[model samples]
Target: MFDIKSFFKREVEKKLIDVDDYIFMPERVEMELEGGLLNCVLNSDGRVDIFYSKEGVTEVSSASRKHPFTSFETELNHGVYDDVIDDLIKEVSKIIDGSSKYFRRNKVLPSTAALPSKPPTDL
Candidate 1:
């Protein structure tokens, strides 16, 4: 059986993060076949924002905004469902890579629901 919880745990283990790390989001977040609403969540100590509708969770394509992944997106380099939680880890890695500036300047540290909370300092 495809257990979301177990799969998530496995992914975290694969990523080699502390259990206290920020809980970013879900595995197959925003599965288009499943209406792409993205079963999203945030820090381990925060609340999830569930977007619902009368019908149910709906598909959410990338809004036409200046997304962080502009390079990948503009070039159509990203695979499908690449913006959802676990999938977006690469985006987080990018931030971590350039932590010094964007992380604090943009004020995007891991929030409460963030799993395996991010380190206060990345040095």
Candidate 2:
């Protein structure tokens, strides 16, 4: 007497366990996507911190300070895994397409010093 439904459920659970293991790895996983770099770090509360930088920066501190693109936190489980992944892709695409409001640029202020009346001619 083989229970087909139970068998399939067990198989799916096994696959999910493997994915969970990878997500829980001590080292962060990184990849390049749409002219930017994406980083995933596992947090202690079973959530992942995802960061995107358009400058191709891998360091989180540098990216946050210089070119902060987009960042979010997500908890992935078997039930909502697909939905979460799809939403992540869409968000990243928005950032690359320059349509996301999260995109930011560092502003440089012009100097306020007065200019000289005559130009110095020193050859």
Candidate 3:
């Protein structure tokens, strides 16, 4: 018997771990770019949202569902569910890669804020 709830839980956890690898910060991972700021978050609903902020406002946003596995029928095939999760992982990987690259190119360090300048030597 296929345990849909257990399968979903396992797949979601796996995907979250994969996503966390790209996120160097807590819930909100952010980067600064010439265009603006890029932010991503793993939502409670098992969806990931990417936002682009310019001039202190979000200009663009995109979302992807973590559970790509599932069927309309009450009963689902185990193999099919596995395949869906695989696909979901691949799609999320691309998003993570893209976000990481953007941060790298922009020279933004996640989970870090610029520190104050050193005081004068004379002080």
Candidate 4:
């Protein structure tokens, strides 16, 4: 007799494992761009933090003490992690590349007021 319940359970477990490996396990990823370093960090609560820092600076101090040039936070879902991350990178890249002046004009910083009023749903 086929065990449907067991099969479904295994499938779900495998999906979770894949999500963990693809998203959570990395913890932090960095990319160096023309303007500075772009940092992405995954928090346990499903929030991803993307920030920018100047080149050659100590990541720890910049991340801890100074306000990031720009910061984006979004919840990562199993199937949408890749899109979410890519979108964030594009947004930050625009800012760093000087193609977008919206952030610069407003001087948005990492603060309660600067946070997105509602979680983004476009992903």
Candidate 5:
């Protein structure tokens, strides 16, 4: 009974950005967030894999295609949807705040601080 459209309408839209309907799996739901795809994949094992990705940066790909992903898991039962959503929000915040390893490697640092000590001395 996990309906993507219903979930977005009831759960995500006002709290998060209003994403266009783009559900990909019968057991999963997804939306565009912070230039990436925010996914909730409901596994047969009764766990949900919440993830974010910037690899397939397109609405169509985010909707219908596959790409490499980074994720964390959560329980799918009980009335813990709020807890799960909170954890997901924390994870996204960590990535955005540049505290996560993925963010360190993937994000472009605005400062020259991380650059090597030597620069091209010629012309």
Candidate 6:
């Protein structure tokens, strides 16, 4: 199992405004942190998001037809999902070693608030 709690700490609320700069993966997408639901914005790579929400996380208010890839896959494995919200998120999610459970049981890719620059090399 992945330490989702810490994962959130490291990525979800890292104060990273322009996540695109931190991650340079081809599929990484930018992210927007909201109440609970991490909405995935449409991009050339993919239009979806991957996240683990707290119990009271936000929900999708507007009704829709197809469940985005994130929603669909999330239904299967609650731990992780994928969407193309921005360039950064898309890129981060693709890396197998990006995180502890990157592609296995706990692989996930979520965005967070922007932070001051600390040099990509530092990260």
Worst 10-residue lDDT window for candidate 1 reads 60-69
Report backbone clashes per prediction.
Answer: 24, 0, 0, 0, 0, 28
**lDDT by residue (tens digit), candidate 6, 1-123:** 889889888885555533333422223222344322354333333333344232333232221213232433343235333232233333334442244533555555578989868757865
List CA RMSD, all candidates.
Answer: 23.0, 13.6, 17.1, 18.1, 17.5, 25.1
- Global lDDT scores for all candidate models: 0.37, 0.48, 0.48, 0.49, 0.48, 0.38
Off by over 4 Å in 6: 1-35, 55-123
Residue pairs clashing in model 3 are none
lDDT, candidate 4, residue 89? Answer: 51
TM-score leader: 2
lDDT of 5 by residue, 1-123 (tens): 778898778675454422223332336766775556667665543344666656432211112222112122222333334355555555655555555545556778687557767887885
- Quality of model 5 by C-alpha lDDT: 0.48
| Runs off by more than 4 Å, candidate 4 | 1-26, 53-86, 89-123
Q: For model 6, what is the C-alpha lDDT against the true structure?
A: 0.38
Of candidate 2, the 10-residue stretch with the lowest lDDT total is: 61-70
For model 2, what is the alpha-carbon lDDT of residue 59? Answer: 26
Error of 5 at 32 (Å): 2.6
TM-score for predicted model 5 compared with the true structure: 0.32
Better of 2 and 6 by TM-score: 2
- TM-score sort, best first: 2, 5, 4, 3, 1, 6
Q: In model 3, where do residues sit more than 4 Å from their true spots?
A: 1-26, 65-123
Question: What TM-score, computed on C-alpha atoms, does each candidate reach?
Answer: 0.17, 0.34, 0.29, 0.31, 0.32, 0.15
RMSD of 1: 23.0
